[model samples]
Target chain A: MTQPIEKIETPKGERFIIPIGPQHPALKEPGHFEFTVDGETVKDATVRLGYVHRGIEKATESRNYIQNLYLLERICGICSHTHAMTYSLGVEKLAGVEAPPRAQAIRVIVAELERIHSHMLWLGVAAHEAGFDTLFMYSWRDRETVMDLLELLSGNRVNYSANVLGGVKFDITPEQAGDVLKGLDFLEGRNRHYLDVVSNDALLLGRIRGVGVMTQADAERLGAIGPTARASGVALDVRIDAPYIAYKDFQPALITETAGDLEARFKVRVREIEESIRLIRLLLEHLPEGELVARMPRRIPAGEAISRVEAPRGEAFYFIKSNGTDTPARVKVRTPTIFNMATVLSLAKGLQLADMPMILVGIDPCFSCNDRMVTVREAERAETWTWNELREHGIKVYQR
Target chain B: MSNLVDQITAGLKTWARVNSPWVIHFNSGSCNGCDIEILATLTPRYDLERFGVKLQGSPRHADVLVCTGPVTRQARERLIRIYEQMPEPKFVVAVGSCAVSGGVFEGCYNVMGGIDRVIPVHAFIPGCPPRPEAIIDGVVKLLSSLQSPAPVQPIMGPDGGKA
Candidate 1:
């Protein structure tokens, strides 16, 4: 297969290509990235996704609204609720039915819990990539408390299909609320300790400090989202910018960092984890009381609605167009990882070949999440590129 | 004398393989649920490493392939390439409902059914994304079958033969 969008030519030294995906040990999901290296320095990098694409967007067009709800939940398991919630929120907007206040609060609670599970997962994965296995083990161990809480609230763990068409399927009982509060207390201590550890640990600091740097201007220009942008001081969070569902009632505190390095990204995520714990507690304390669901027709009203939610990785934006039929006209999902890919690719250049893994994992490159909508068929051919031609092409594109 | 020696070496190899199974996980096309659960099994909480099940990076160094997700069109060839790269006496455990029967992803344009369609599966751990405990149970079940008296049949196709 042709390596996509990579060219490196340094006449002084020999350059070789290193393909680090599809089945590489370092990556968890299936996405191909080729780094052109001169000695130990990476001169260029290119990414090819769609290895995890299952025609989800196309599949959504065929299925009805109810079926699409279940299908959409499977888009990215870690942020499954966000996908469902986003889809439901958009569908409800088109149908013009407001979800009950109690249900909206319940959605926010689960969303916050999901954020905690996701960040802890990312922390462990990022740490593991940096050869900090001890921290990885410790973080994952603490992650279970949130996992158990999620499973208790919703029957399932990863893909918590809590959001229904107009409301949520589950509600928090007093007993469950108490358990969640206790869980949050334990998690709060652990997160603080982790915050201290990541900031203080010499080993991690050495690896991540000043690595994969992205400035605020570049972050905005590259269109980075979620914690990745927040780390670079972009200060763009969907929950805060545009409140939806329960977010209006319980607003999230925006967390941002100035460094714009790998360490900055780590800090943003860890701090967000703390923020999520606090949000969950506040939601529990002021738990609303009402019916869990509202009635809506199977066929959604003919209209298009946009839904954007802050997923753990970043913004999960969805555009739903209904044609007054059971099936949707178009269901477009722009996952956070894809929005942050340009930033990752730009960061991959001019770094040590060994440090590439850390940069790639810094944004928690969820290929499954990013490539769920786009499908690219790998052609049977080998394409080559020269350094000067690539630079000239880039310059021309920039000039235009 | 030669036959006896051959049997002894084979027995030793089987015993070694049965004892320590190094795993390499590949997410062909999944929701990240099953993959995380698999990683969780490796951490301190579940600690599948305690059973000598190390999650290796290279396919050549590994004995078992812990496959997750449905076989997508773009990933189909790459999945096959990975399966073919593994050393002999290899086993594949299809973890999650998607790998078993394409689960919810079945009939999607890009989905090509289960992992078994592309690779011979020894055990199918059925769950949307199986819990860490369930994943451990599935791995343990596979190990026990390897030690069973009867031969292990990998691919359960209509032809009913071992791969």
Candidate 2:
């Protein structure tokens, strides 16, 4: 499955193939990457994912709308809120209902707060990949502020199960709002210091500056989204382009950098942290007073609905189909990582093998988020296995 | 005198292993909820290293295998291989709800339920994704259990067989 492409063969008879994962130290999740390198320079790269594929889409069909809400939230722990929110917004659309204004505003607050946690998490991971443990430690140490804020709003630290069918599960009190603001103030200062270190610090700049330079044209050509494309000067943000929920009232200031290098990705994300801080503050100041959840019917009408929202990494998309039953007919999730994965392959060529981790982390690749399906292709035919067939096949293999 | 020296050496080795238990984390098929929290345990706030639990890169050098999520079929073989690679007397800590009992991912076609299906798990930290403190407590308890007079036997599977 991880065979190196033959077409990109080098002039030399012998090729140095480096297979990175499925279980590599650099990657926290399970993914397989085969890079064809010429001495230290990479000539071609191919990635094989599905190591962390849990069949969440198939699982969603069996579960009801409410159960699926929690199921989808587990798609990517970093962007768990985005997944739940996207699914809920689509389900609510299918049900012909909208969450109350207060619920919508609270959703935005949590989403932005999740974004802060995600970006900080990414910053730490990227720094760790760069061998800058100091920045990694400091950034993650401060990330707890946002994590605490999320916990304060909703109970859990990671899953946060904040979204339900038509609205959110909880409302932020005046005291919780005060706590969130205090945390954000502290985060804003730490993020500013991080921004300075990532941009101006001589040692850190050496590892990031001018490395993995993905031009704006290349980024757009390869369908790069989120901070990865924004760093390349592509002004594609789901919040700004199509306002959903409370985004229509509380808009986020676009943060983009023209460098399109690893440094730009760092800058754009760090700057966006400040931007998210401002958006959360504004939303808290004018949080609408209303019901948390609107009335949603148990059985949704037979129809199809699409939901799109800006996740921390990029735009998270969902397609939900209902059959007038309690359970959904089908649920298709297209996470942002899939869209941005192409950038890594394109950028892999002509770069040193050492810069691979930095380039890979630049897109914030989430294997679990993107590994939704495995298409088995055979010679002269392609086949789709039914649930029963798949189960039998699994049983047969395990029995062997 | 030789028997006494051997006992003292074994005691010293246990003390060292308990105090500085190196861990290697693997996401078998998890949502990464547990993986990140496990990471949080190491960072400054939680400071899991205070107990000398270092997150290692290679399984060969690790003392404990920190497994997250339900074991997916694709990752099961690799999980077994990783568990096998660690030096003998290794401890496996299954973190998160998915890892313990497959939790919400129980009926998923691709999921193989818990990590214990493929490997022996010494400690089970049950949470959707357990909090860092919970993870810390789980590891600490696993370490302290080594202080027992008898060696802990591997938990048997339902079929009364070792994985």
Residue B162 lDDT in candidate 2 = 35
lDDT of 2 by residue, A1-400 (tens): 2222233334654456655553421122346666776755778988775556778899999998889988888887788899999999999999899999999999999999999999999999788767678988999999988888888889989888889888989989999999999998899889889989998998778878998998899999999999999999999999999999999988898999999999999999999999999999999999999899999986899999999999998988899999999999999998887677789889999987667767877898753222111222222222322222222332332232
Q: Which residue pairs in model 2 clash with each other?
A: none
Cα TM-score per model: 0.89, 0.90
Per-model chain B TM-scores are: 0.93, 0.95
Instruction: Name the regions of candidate 1 deviating beyond 4 angstroms.
Output: A1-11, A22-30, A367-400, B156-163
Model 1 chain B poorest ten-residue lDDT run: B154-163
Q: Please tell me the interface RMSD, in Å, for model 2.
A: 7.9
DockQ score for model 1, please? 0.47
Residues A1-400 of candidate 1 have per-residue lDDT tens digits of: 1233334233567666655553321122345677776765778877776555678899999999989999999887788899999999999999989999899999999999999998999998788667677898999999999999999999888888898899999889999999999999999999999999889988788888998899999999999988999999998988999988888988989999999999999999999999988888888888888989988866688999998998988888899998998899999998877777788779888887667667877888753222111112133333433222232332333232
